[model samples]
Target: MLRELLADTIMQSAQLAERPEITTPPPGVSAHFSTAVAMRLAKQEKKSPMEVAAAIASKVQENAPFGLFLAVEVAAPGFINLTLTPDAHRGVLAEIREGGERYPAIPRKGGRTIVEFLSANVAKPLHVGHLRNAVLGDSLSRILEASGEEVVRWNYLGDWGTQFGKLIVAWRRWGQEEELQKNPIAHLVALYVRFHKEAEKDSSLEEEARSEFRKLEEGDAENRHLWERFRAMTIRGIDAFLVRLEIPPFDEDKGEAFFEGDITPLIAELQERGFAKESEGALIVPLDAYNLPPGMIRKSDGGSLYLTRDIANLRYRLDKYSPQRILYVIGNEQSLAMEQLFAIAAMLKLDSAQLRHVKYGLVLGESGKKFSTREGNTVAAEEILDEAQRRAVNIVNE
Candidate 1:
């Protein structure tokens, strides 16, 4: 936030810092700096950059803002360049000392924020692929908290999904209860990987998986028992891993799937509010205003999606905490979906609740490609962590 404010302020202050004559003809060339301000102005003013630079230089004199510059120069095509005196730099230093952290910084205003992150599936071990969300979400939550916003850090685990059924099948087929006693996550991951391998040749495995999921969803004793055990094991592993990385434990809300049982009324409310509509037997909220791809609320199979569950979750949050804002520290890949969600929320007249999506770019491999960690993998989070630690150790020792 401060970064954004400073950029704006710097541009504004630069204009005022220059003499009127220097800035009038060029429009944007400032007498206080030397970084293409005149060239940019020339482009905007439809003149040669040199002409802009000359016009700006003509007005520069001793009596500039902060008493920083006495003259300006026109360089190359149309660049107004400035040579600042020692007093200017010293004054800046003084300003820095006086302002402290708020040196051109946006003051933290009180508000409530909900941060959802690290939503990996429960059936599989949280792999290297899931590290970005965990780290990024956790970091953003910390930053928000530090900035004086009341933050509710949510993990939103992908625990309630179809993959769990496959895990259940694997556990019944070839799982060892004794090994799970030693290390639950490793034991479950082994079974999960084995299940995937076996399911390839045996097509009947898919049906078996679905049956297991149905039983679990219907609250069958055995399937529920297995899922509980798996969820506990995975969460425990995640906690330990986060500790090892020195990252604080993320708050958990378990995401949309966890709230599905309680979202029917939410869907009804959406219909009442005219936010959701039935399209080809599935529920959808049209997102033309958002300029995004169509977002599905519910699938034809009677299963809900993130959008529907999010509406329910938002309503729940609104009712419970009455938060001022919802911050999603998500990856850039889901930008369109997030925009659509925000648009729908707005259409439902949730103007009081500010919805923000902080998206980060993809972390690419050194070769500028998407990273993978399989046999032919280019990148792995664990390996990156290990190497980082190694470098730190070397630096400390040196």
Candidate 2:
């Protein structure tokens, strides 16, 4: 479509007819005229660029469409720059009139996709690193949706882990009853930080945390209630923050614990398919092809890890939605983990469900470092939104 209209002008002129190539623009200059065409062409023709440019300029001035090119001149070694007239500049405005939003971009014909991201542990406060992941994933989902694919946004909350047992112990020990009622996420993060610091000091705390985790896994009513309460309060807090930021938060599945009752059969299926094997008492899937040290499905203590839960989650999604693709948006550091997971999934013969991992780079601060909050050396995620708003307010006042 583009070539039909422009080919006439390109072919008729003697200089352009000899030119082997053409180009659009330059790096630093922003002009209505396409500047780099003659330079790009001269190289292909194997001619001295200034001579080629001079010849091209004469032809361009004579045969240019709408008498647009005011000048065609050689700059530096071989740069042939072309400047357009005011009348030629107005053509861009005419194109804008022709197309509104669906202008020149081609539409994608991909099938439905499931995007899973922002699976931060409910026990801790979201840090700066998590903020970037959340924002990037949310933006990408919007772009996919715009391009005509059905997008199912998900948050695989990290609710099931050994850390919960420690949190349960810490809550019973130093957690304030009133502060938790006021702001549960902050209280839970404080308790989690304290529990890790304590466990480091007193090694016996590890065993205690393990015992508590086992009790939680076994569906002890008291531990279950505590976990549920913590999860609910934290989700509420996160919802408030998302609402303030005007971000559409995903429909959260919470974690593997949410589907714990149904995972037994899936784990059995993995073992039946020979995808799962016992390695030092832990159920693992050897992913040599992926260059990963086996993906652990279960720990030596007969407790399930992330792989087991993911396999179960994959099966559940396939049965429920039958989506064409599943996108895992996480940090680049976990590339090996995702590769292993997909390899194991293939071994289990669930290859129909397409899996994608969109890894993103860090949003560095002014010092060209990963943004941090607690240490004053980097910008905090919490403060970024407020700072943007303050800048907007100042600009409006000016």
Candidate 3:
């Protein structure tokens, strides 16, 4: 914002056709801002840079607002350095006070936006990767809101999938009600990890997991109750983490399982409209036009995939909230999946709202590799904050 104000001042002072570049002075510069536009103009105007700098600085000081610039000095190498007056500093503080909880920004008046992030699976603790996603998404939403967009923070949780079945199987085998009550998320993660370890030895465990999920899909009462319980427990743990991180509750939190009943009709509509075709016993939408591999709607076993549920979610969003834009904060590993999702949306003509995948890089550890556990990205995000707090308290004590 100060840059914009400075650019305007320079444009008026020099009678330039365009605004000059205003940049922050480096450390130890003893100035708030600096610009080298005089040097740039010297090349074209055939004048010495010092002369141009002096002329602009004099003109700027002459016409500057009262109490705006304490000093506008011409530095060597044709730079114009500006130091702000106390009044200018007070004005910035006033604006920040007025903005309050919202992030301060020059308003763009952009339309409504829905940012979806931290869609962690229901079967595990939020990992370090998810922590970055949460922080980035929350910051972006605040920024977007400050820029005059009606921001809606949505966390489209991953509450549905076959892995949940494995978690259920493991839960039945070893889960204790009292132990799970103490810390459900950690217990869930341990169960999920143990399920894989046990399945490695007994291959039949995989089928059993699938059968459990099939029962879930068929709306078996016991399985449905377990699914609901697991979903609720996971949400409570996520809420505790949010409180620790100082992030407010999300505006919307409709998990993938919320669209379970919608996925079947969605696939039917795609097939009925000729957008989907059977490929090797799986329902898929051909994305050859976009140079992407076909997007799978349903697996050969008649289960819904991520993209399928995502389309259902988007369709619901468009029909209900009708946000002008939707952003997905996910890792770069899902770039191809996002592209396929977007392409299929285009094919289906779901063009009411913009769809974006805000891809992020992996969070690395001291070893310069991705921070992950043997169970794959199960390094609990809450532990990172706890460790940092512990170190901070240790330093304070010392």
lDDT of each: 0.69, 0.73, 0.86
Number of the top TM-score candidate? 3
**Candidate 2: residue 155 Cα off by (Å):** 1.0
Write candidate 3's Cα lDDT for 361-388 as tens digits.
8877766777543255546787888898
Model 3 RMSD, rounded to 1 decimal:
4.0
Candidate 1 lDDT over residue span 1-398, tens digit each: 32233234334555534322222234465545454566767767798878766665554443235555545676686555665567766767787788764355545677888877776556455555567777777777777766777777777777776777888898889999899898776677677777777888998998999889888878899888888877877778777668876777765546545787876786788779876788899988777777766678878877777777777677677777777887877779888878877787788776677888878777776687765321233343566678889999999999
| Models ranked on TM-score | 3, 2, 1
Predicted candidate 2 versus true structure: per-residue lDDT over 264-291, tens digit per residue: 7877877897767887777877787767
- C-alpha displacement of 351 in model 2, angstroms? 1.6
TM-score of each: 0.66, 0.70, 0.83
Against the true structure, candidate 1 reaches a TM-score of 0.66
Better of 1 and 3 by TM-score: 3
- The clash numbers for all candidates, in the given order, read 4, 0, 0
Give the Å error, residue 230, model 3: 1.4
